[model samples]
Target chain A: TQLLEQSPQFLSIQEGENLTVYCNSSSVFSSLQWYRQEPGEGPVLLVTVVTGGEVKKLKRLTFQFGDARKDSSLHITAAQTGDTGLYLCAGPNNAGNMLTFGGGTRLMVKP
Target chain B: NAGVTQTPKFRVLKTGQSMTLLCAQDMNHEYMYWYRQDPGMGLRLIHYSVGEGTTAKGEVPDGYNVSRLKKQNFLLGLESAAPSQTSVYFCATGSIRRQPQHFGDGTRLSIL
Candidate 1:
């Protein structure tokens, strides 16, 4: 089975700090997705990167897909208390029908 | 829009109890999925349905069963609850494969 691994499983930072979370995989995927889940709620999709080396920005968040399509990263600029949540990266499985998610990076931005 | 709705936001059951988690969608999505989230395991797919009357096993489907009798509703059943099965359950729906899916708030189940 394909797997996505995330680094820095737990992160604690002050507001205005910048942080980046990495998601790596050994197998290549057709596309990758980023999600942020807050406490007591399901994950909400942040972005989807379909092309290798592609980058997408959402307000204070930026996401990038690796050149080989085997990895992805999420960068937060000037993190705020509201930005604190669990960030997850996922990609389609071998069957291209379902998604395989990374363990996730739990971020806490204190004001 | 009430995109996806999961009933029983929180539930606690003893061993050998039987229960069903209901997922209803109003977006006319063709694909629906059930996943369980643990502390550090991410979200593991338990089961999925492509359309009405069709269901398939996912990565971890050993202790659960699912059925999709209607296009907009999916049901997950646990025949005999086990302590290991305690986790936060989420239901999601997508219009097509390989695209972003819409998710519900999630149902937290604790098996004692």
Candidate 2:
């Protein structure tokens, strides 16, 4: 099984709509990170949450880490067409130098 | 500076053929990783290195091998490619703390 699992594998919403993607894991991580990947490009770091029950906002996107550090969520408000891409969550492994990535959530904002 | 660069953006190989994908990073990171992405699957780690001259197996290391002879460069090699090995390969460099990572575009490989 995948170390991390993401919900709603595919999400399509109209422009200006709001949507949330979730990532869950059974293992605890010191920190969790969110990344967005566009076609023909590599995934880009969006935000990182180091504290349990931490919340971070990046422009129209908000990220939250569960209090247990086993899950995370990314919410985008007033979504735009440019938000169409893949959103992934990752956390460090037991070694702290390697990472285990979530399956991924594909988001599409129609114009 | 180029954050991360991958060579031969795309390639096609016949079954049993061997090839190598190169990844270079300029961020002076101490850790590097290789992952493969397929439809419906998030990226799966194939191999990783904490520093020069050291490598470790990841979740999905089968059919793949890696070498990190130099800190700035990491290489993934396919000893004998199979159709099941067709996927997009990505290389990433981790931050000092390893929370977030910087990734190379990707190398799309096809084995027929």
The best candidate by TM-score is 1
Please provide, for model 1 over A1-111, each residue's C-alpha lDDT reduced to its tens digit, 9 standing for 90 to 100. Answer: 999999999999999999999999999999999999999998998898999999999999999999999999999999999999999999999987689999999999999
State the iRMSD of every prediction, in order shown. 1.8, 2.3
Q: Write the per-residue lDDT of candidate 2 for residues B7-82, one digit (tens) a residue.
A: 9899999999999999999999988989999987888889888889999988889898899999999999999999
Cα lDDT of candidate 1 equals 0.93
Candidate closest to the true structure, highest lDDT: 1
What DockQ results for candidate 2?
Answer: 0.66
| Model 1, span B13-103: residue lDDT tens | 9999999999999999999999999999999999988889999998899989999999989999999999999999999998877454899
Candidate 2 residue pairs that clash: none
lDDT of 2 by residue, A1-111 (tens): 327889889999999999999999888878888899998888998988999999999999999999999999999999999999999988888876567788799898999
Range of the 10 consecutive residues with the lowest summed lDDT in candidate 1 chain B = B94-103
